[model samples]
Structure formats: C-alpha cells, structure tokens
Target: MNTQDAGPLLEIRRLTTRFQTQNGALNAADDVSLMVGKAETVGVVGESGCGKSVTSLSVLRLVPSPGKIEAGSILFDGEDLLSKTSRQMEGIRGKDISMIFQEPMTSLNPVYTVGKQVAEALLVHNPALGRKRARDQAIEMFGHVGISEPKSRFDTYPHQLSGGLRQRAMIAMALICRPKLLIADEPTTALDVTIEAQILRLMKKLQNETGTSILLISHNLSVIAETCDRVYVMYSGRIVEESDVFDLFDRTLHPYTSGLLASIPRKNSAIEPGKPLHSIPGGVPDMTRLPCGCKFAPRCEEVMEICCREEPTLADAGGGHCVRCWKFLGRKAVKV
Candidate 1:
C-alpha cells in the first residue's frame, strides 16, 4: 500500500541525538526525519560515522551512555517512544521492534548456546513459554533462516558456526518474536557476495511472509538498491536526499547523493586502465563542531555561496523526492 493510503509503522520527526564528547556535545543525529510504511523496506545509506546506526538505535531508545535524545519525537504505531519508561521499553523492544546488529560475532553471546540466545527473546516476552517449547521454536527459526542441521546448530556456540551461519543465527534471533519492524544495521557487511545475496533474498521472503517493515542501514548503495523500496541519503548526521529507489538512481538530486551514486563500481561499464574511480572529495566534518552551514559544502562539487552561508532544509522537489541543497532553493551556482 502507498504511504498516503496507510499511516507509517514508524515515523521519526526531527529526531536529534547528541553525545558528550571530549570536544563537547556532538549531534550524532541532527533533526533527522524519515518513515517506514507498513511492510515497506526503507534504507538509510551513507558513509561510515554518518549517524545511520545512531538513528536506528534512537528509535529503540538503545543509545548508550554519553548519548541522549536531545529533541524531536519517535512515533511507533502512534505512540511516542521517548515518553515511554525504560521498563515499558523492555516490553516493546523484542516483541514489536527488533534489531539485527552489524556484527553477529560480537552481538551474539559467546557464553550461551545459539538456541539459548535466540530463545531469550521469546522467554522474556512470553513468560508462558517453557524451556522445551522455546528450544523447539528457536530450532524452527534456525531452519527458516537456512541453517544446516538446525537441531545440531541450536546447541552450537557462535564460535562454532561459520560466518554466514553466525549471521543466520543472528537473523533467527531477531525474527524469533515475529516483530512488526526490523532494523538491520549493515547486516551483510562481512559476508561474501553470494551469501549477501542469499541473506537479502531471505530477508525479503521473510518480510513477505510476516509483513514486517524494515529499516535497513548500510553504506553500500548496491545493497540498498537490491532491497529497499525507498531510500534516504545521509551525510554528516543529517539526511541530504530522500526518494523512491528508481527515482534515486534515475534522477538523483543533491551533490552528495550524486557523488555516492557515481562511486559505485559497474562491472559492465568500460574502465580505462589508468583512470581512477570517482570518489567524493574532502572528508566528513567534525560532529562536535560542525560548520555553520551545510555539512557537505566542502565536498559538494556544485556548491554555491548560499550553501556555505545558509544551511538548507529538506524541501520537496516533487513526487515526495526531497533534497537539502541550495540549488534546489533557487540559488545560482557560483564556483569559487
């Protein structure tokens, strides 16, 4: 269903998350806004340390010490998460919303068997579930995620499983409760191409089966292209551009989004032997002390005088395609 016809499953409006650093307070997520429709797979794409992970963590109120949600609201199914108590969050975390963290090896417990780890959510959320029932359900989930010999693998530790298997175990754990929304933070970062494709396909299939909305966070544009229905392009902790998947590729706006799209390597496209691949110029700004204007002004090729003087807000260009750029704000490009 289209977004207009049905309300969003998760709506984050101007959510700002800050961290207390040596330099001072850093805005890890600055007035970030996005939404995930029912059963929709939305993606957040950007370079490393661009607040993709922080945005997801803030939704679940999982931001660690030294970091705080400074402003705005996170609305999930019409309820404001920021208003919920920590004890109330425990009931919502695994049952209604779940997260598949970046690294399975580190996210999974080495001390516990995979079965115990996977079943923990079920046992915690549903106290009526007995140990044997939880174990059986966990094994079933392992099979669903394509683990070999699911029964035997249930007893295995995270170290005992292969990289792909460990990832599958993590997926099983995340999906065990059949959550309404799944926030996957670079779920396929460490896997091989073949395994990555398989995992993506499996996630899509499960999403179809369970009608679970997904908020996928990754730096890989290709991965986002392969799965997401809509995309948000983030840079320096703020959303720069957002559009449907096809519009993003076909009619990309914002210099930063264009730069990201241009950097993707195309196997079929001819490449000159000595020519270097295109990369976005300059580096991400310091979060503790970001520039007064656009965060990407230093790297933006089509940057104008206004870009360095006045920060642009996300304005709709048409068809729900929004961009945060001075060019979209009717300013003429002035090359320095």
Candidate 2:
C-alpha cells in the first residue's frame, strides 16, 4: 500500500478530555489534534501523565468514569466518532478499530480463560461464528503470538499465564479480528528487553501483513524510533512537536523534546566516569492547576519571558515539522 497516496484512517481535531477533580475540572487532553494515515504508524511519545494514554482512550470513547470527552472531534475514516451512540461505538470498537491496553492483568478478566477472552473479542465483532470456530481461531491466534502449546494455553486462566504470555494473549485478542486501526498503549511495558523486541517485531510484521495503521503510545523514545513512521512529542497534555521519526531525532525543535532525546542513553558512546545519567529537571505539571501560559516554562532551560506570559500554538516549521515554542514562532528566546 502506498501510504503517501492513502488518506488518513483516523484524524483527531481539537480534542479535549476533562476529569472532575475536587479542586475543579482538570483538562487531561487540551485541544490535542493528530492524524494516523492508512497503513502508517504514528507514535505519541511523552513522560507519565502527559495524556498519551488518555488520548488513545478518548479515541475509542472509552474514557473512564469521572472523565469525559469535553470537546472536539474524533474522525475515523472521515466519520465523526464523537457523535456516535454507545451502541454504535460498541460495533466500532473491536471491529473497525481495536486497542491493546497498557496492562494485561487489569484489562483481561481474571475469571475467564485466556482463550475465552480472545474468542469473545472475535465473537463480538463477528457474531455469526460458532463457538467451535471461535475456539479454534483463538488457538490459532495464540500460536501466531508465539505462545507455546496454544491448545493447552487456551483453557488456562489469566493468573495461570506469565506476564509475557498474558501480554501476548492481549495482543492476540486485539488483533484477532484484523481491525483497520490499532491503538497500542505501552504494549511492551513490563516485559524483558528480549520479549519487548519480540513483541514490537510481531506488531510490525502483523501490520505489514494486514496493512493496519498503528497509533503506538510509549515513553521509550528508542521504541518509538524503531517502530514509528511519524512521531508526536506530547507535553502536559499538548503536542509540543511533530515530525517524521528521522527528522524528529535529527532536528528536534521543542525544548521538551530535546531534553527527552538528551536523556536517552547512547550505546557505545563514551561517557565520563562518575557522571550520572542525564535527566530532565522538575516534574510533570499538575493537570488540575496548570500554569496559565506555557505549561513547561517552569522547567525549560531555554525559557523566555514571553513563555511565562503567553501560550504558544503549534505552527509548521517547514518540511512538515511543527513546533509549539516561541523560538520556532518567529520570536527570539531571551535569556532568563
């Protein structure tokens, strides 16, 4: 498939998700906009609490209680999903688009057998299939995910499986129906490096075979670099920079993105003894009480006076790269 010629499979425009807090309504997702082209892989990279996972959940209209999609549109195949009814979304969710949630233990049912969960996903989307066929297909999926003795594992409960096996089962459940889009939230988290590589490779291979677009959410820049075509750097619930993966690594424009890239430990690179690993100073801003101006201004090394008084909008910085910093917005950064 020619990705260049294909239109976007999913487009999110000005999406804002909010949660009710004791203090007030906290904007978990603040006017976030992004797209995933057909047969393309887009990565949403950020530290914890940046709303990467919330953005994914909001796409599926599955935001947890106390939180709701307060504004904006989620366009899937050019249709607005925000306008869809819950019943309609039910048909959309595991059929047209599927999600592999962050954790398998919490996402998968403890009482049901692993095979049953996989079979249920298939059955929900393709309800005409018989139980026997669903069972057989579940076994097949388990095998495809590299689970040993698929037939035996099919009857085992979630607690009986190891973390890697459980995660594999979650992947199997997510992909069994071959949806057009896959929203994978931290798919390889908590796994060993070897298993993490295997899972990423499996997702890539499956995407190639099925021509499915992927929205990969991760905090690991290295994973995003390896698996994504385009990348969006999110900070404090807003996109700070977006570009092609190679361009993002080569010429990252946002200070937050630069800090994140600097923190990555380089392999085979000479390091001075007694020096500590690089870390971005400060912490993620509290969503309930975010700053009035640039949310990252407090911690940014290149912070300017205007950054503390004005919020910057994401603007194109040539060659499809967009940045939301004053330095890229035709304003010179002043020394603090």
Candidate 3:
C-alpha cells in the first residue's frame, strides 16, 4: 500500500452506542469517529470504562444485550455496516473484519481442541470447505503464529497450552481468513512481558505480510507508541484528542492527553516515597450525570469557569491534529 494513495479500510463516523443501565440508557460511546487506513494501525487508548472497549464492539456491531447503536454510520469498504442485517453482518464478520478478544481463556471454548477452535473460524466463514481442509489450514495458521510443530499442537486442547500459546492460538484463529480489518481489544493483557512483546511482533509481521489494517485498544501508552501510526484519546465516551503518534505524545493539545502522558514515569524521574502521589484526580464521572461543561473538568487542574458552562467541540488545531478543549476552540495554539 502506497503511503499517499492508501484509503481507509474502516471509517467510523459519528458513531453513538448507548447501554441500558439502572439509572437510564447511557452513551458508552458518544459520537466517536476515526479511520483505519489500509495496512495502518490505529490505537484507541484510555482508562477502564472510558469507552475503549465499547467503541470496538460498536464497530463490529457486537454490542451486548441492552445496548444499541443509536446513531451514526460505520462504513467498511464504503458500505454502511450499521444498516446491515444479522445475516449480512455474518458475511462481513470474519471474511472482512475479525477481532481478537481480551482474554483467550474465557473467549475460547473449553470443550474443543485449539485446532478445532481455529478450524471452526474457517468453517464458519467458508462452509464449502471440508473439515479435512479446515483442519490443515488450522495447523498452518498455528505455524504462522509461531507455534512449533503445529501439526502436533493441532490435536492439543486449549487447556494444554500455556498462556502465551493460548494467546497465539487466539490470534491465529482470528486471522485465519486474512480479514482486511482486525480489531484487537487488549489482546495482550494476560500475557507476561516477554510473551506480550512476542505477540505484538507477530501481529506486526503478519500485518506486513497480509496487508491487514488493525485497530488496537489498550491502556498502555508505550505499546500504542510502538505500534500505532495514529491514535485517539477517549474520555467519558468522547474522543478528546487525535493525531499522529509522535505529535500526540510530544506535543499534546488536550489536557486529558497531557495528564495521561504525565502519569507515566520517565526513566530518569526522581523517585520519592509517598510525596502526595501523582494522578489525574477524581473518578470517571457518572455516565448518566456527566458534567455539562467538560467530562474531564472536575478532574482537570486548570479548569476555568467557561469549561464548566459549555461543551468543547473537536476542531482542527493544525497538521491534521484535532482536540476538544475551550483553550483551542476556533483557534490554533499560538506556540512560542
């Protein structure tokens, strides 16, 4: 894919997802939009309950019961995914877009072998394929994901594999059909450091080989920095900031983005014991009763009166960067 000519494989526009709760239906993902260009990686980062997971589920139209995509469009290959029927979605699910979930232990079935699980993915997409061919392809996918002696492993059950191997199996299963877009939601949360690095590298390798675009959802800034070409910072169901990875971390325009970077300790930071610890302060606002001004205003140290009176709009700051903040609304930051 040429850098300049690449078009978005998946484009989310003004997508809003609401879930029914005890209080009322709340926007788990509110008017969030971003693009994943061909062979590109887009990272969605934020704390837990900040709509990171909800956004991905909405894109895949897999929102849990009691949740609905209230408005907006999800375009894949220039078609509206939100309007598709369940049968229509089935055709696109694995053949065009696939997802690797957070935990393989819970995501995988205990009753089936690792090979059977991966083979099932293929069988679901291509029913014409016989079980024998599906089994062979499953073994082949295991090798593609770096499992040694894939044929032997094919007969092994998920319980027999280690945590890293199970994750590998999950990745293999997800990519068996070589889908155009891959949505990986915290795919490495359960692995150890070494295995996590391996899985990341494996995904990168396969992506380059197959020209697959990826949407990686994670809380680890370092992981996002290493893999994603672009990123979105979400807060209280809204995308607060978005830009190229280098510009995002180096010259963040939103206060929430700045606080996220500040929370991560540098290698040379001086360590002091219990010196009033550092954090953004305040819990995630109640979804049903979010502040009228800014979702993050209650926790922002630099909050001003205007920040509490009006909601900020995502506007162009410069160089394809977008931020929602009163300070930068309708004008670029006059940097000195």
Candidate 4:
C-alpha cells in the first residue's frame, strides 16, 4: 500500500463494546473512533483497564465471549469488518490483519515447538504451502526477526527460549504473512530495557520493509512517543485526546494527558534529591458504576461544575489536535 494515500487502512467509527457481568453490562470500549493510515503507526495508550486492549480486540472481532460489540463499524481496506462472517474473519485475520499479544509465554502454545507454532500460523492461512515449505519460511522469518541460529531454534519449545526470543517468535508469526496491519498489544512489556529497545526497533524496521500499518496498544507513554506517528489517549474506555506524536508532547491539551506526561521521570530534571516521582492521584474508575458526566472529572485537577454535570465531547482545539475536556472547550469553570 502506498503511504501517500489519503484514506486510512483501518478506520473504526463510534465503536461501543460491552461486557455482560453479574452487575450489568459495562462498556469496555465506549463510542471509540480512531484510524490507522497505510504504513502509519497509530497508538492507543492508557493505564491498564482503560480499554486500550479491548479496542484492539474489537478491531479483530476477538473481544472474547461475554463481551459483545454492541455498536460500531470497523472498516479495513474500505470493507466493513463487522459485517463479515466468522469464517471470513478467520481468513482475514492472519492474512490481512495479525496481532502480537501482550505476553508471549501465555500466548504461545506450550506444548509445541516455537518454530512449529510460527509455521502453523502460515499454514493456517495458506495451507497449500506444505509443512516443509512452511517450516522453511518460519526459519527464514526467525532469522529476519534476529533470532540466533534459526535452524537450531526451530525445534526448541516455547519454554526453552528466553522472554525476548519468545516475543521475536510471536512477531515472526504475526508478520510471516505480511499482513496489511499489525496490532501489537504491549509487545515489549515483559522484556528488559535493552530487549524492549531492540523489539521496538525491529518493529519499526519491519514496518519500513513491509509497509504495514500498526495499531500499537501500550500503557507507557514513552513507548508511544517512540513508536507512534499519531496517538489516541484513552481513559475510562473512551478517547480523551488525539494528536500527532510530536504535538501531543509539545502542546498537551487534556489534563489527563498532562498528568501522564508529568508522571514520566525526566533524566535532566533539576528536582531535589530523593524526591518521589509524580503519580496520578486516583485509580481508574469502576466501569460498571462510572461517575456521571465526565468519567475523568473525579480525577481531573481542573474539574469544572459542568464537567461533573455533563460529559464533554471530543472536539478539535486547533490544528487538528482534538481534546475532550471542558477546560479546552471554552466553557467557564464554575467552582464546586
């Protein structure tokens, strides 16, 4: 796909995914909308349980049982994915859209050789390749992803490889088919800092080689800043801010975004010695009993009466940077 194309490769519109629990239905992803242009890396970032992972799962129609996509349209290559049947979606998953789940140790089948698992992915999508050819391709992919001694590693089981190698094998499986889009959900979560850096670099390198759009889900703002071309800041199952990566760091609008940036430790900062790091005051709200109006109002430092009474829409502030906060909406902040 040409990067210059104006249309996005994956466009999600007004997505609302809900999960049925004993209490009631809770919105895991509420009215979410985002896009990934061809060859562009878009990030969905927030703390855990903020619905970043649910949003990605919705894109692949893999929200898990009991969680239903109540309303939304996921358009991939100008085709609506929600409208496709299960069999059709299966065909598209590995061949058109692939995912690297958060934990490789849990995601990879424990009983099978890591190489065989990767090879199985290719064969599932293209069975005509035959086992021998699939194994050959899988080994080639292992080498491509920087795994040492691909031939020797082919017969090694998942438990035998280190965390980094397991992750690389997962990546190779996801990219073996060269899908149009890759959904990486916390791809580097369990690795050391050095391995994390290598994985991030490898993804970028592979993107350049394959021209695959990536929808990267991560809780770490630093990772998003390094890997994403554009970013969507999610909170309480909804997107509060969307902007170019550079603009997001330079001119943050939402208070939540501000809080998140403040929490990142700065290397060159002149803070007093032994000063503790800054952290957001409160935890994520309970989804089933979310606070009325602005879901983030209770935690927002600049909370207004209007924010507590009415939810703010995601509106453009200026220059295509969108924010969902009363402070940026030109509304007067009445004291509580």
Please write out the lDDT profile of model 1 over residues 66-144, one tens digit for every residue.
8999999998887889999999998998889999976897669999999899998789998799988998999999999
Q: lDDT score, residue 8, model 1?
A: 92
Tell me the TM-score of each prediction against the true structure: 0.95, 0.94, 0.93, 0.95
Regarding TM-score, does 1 or 3 come out ahead? 1
Candidate 1's TM-score reads 0.95
List candidate 4 segments past 4 Å from native: 1-6, 331-336
lDDT of 4 by residue, 1-336 (tens): 223355889999999999999987799999999999999999989989999988999998999889999998998988899999999999999889999987997568999998899999999989899999999999999999999999999999999989999999999989999999999999998889899999999999999999999999999998999999999999999999999999999999999999899888778988678988788888999999999889999998888888898899998867778999888775533433
Instruction: Write model 2 residue lDDT over 301-325, tens digit each, in one string.
Output: 9988888999999988789899999
The candidate maximizing lDDT is 4
Ranking of models by TM-score? 4, 1, 2, 3
By lDDT, the candidates rank as: 4, 1, 2, 3
TM-score of 4: 0.95
Q: What lDDT does model 3 reach?
A: 0.88
Q: What total of clashing residue pairs does each candidate reach?
A: 0, 0, 0, 0
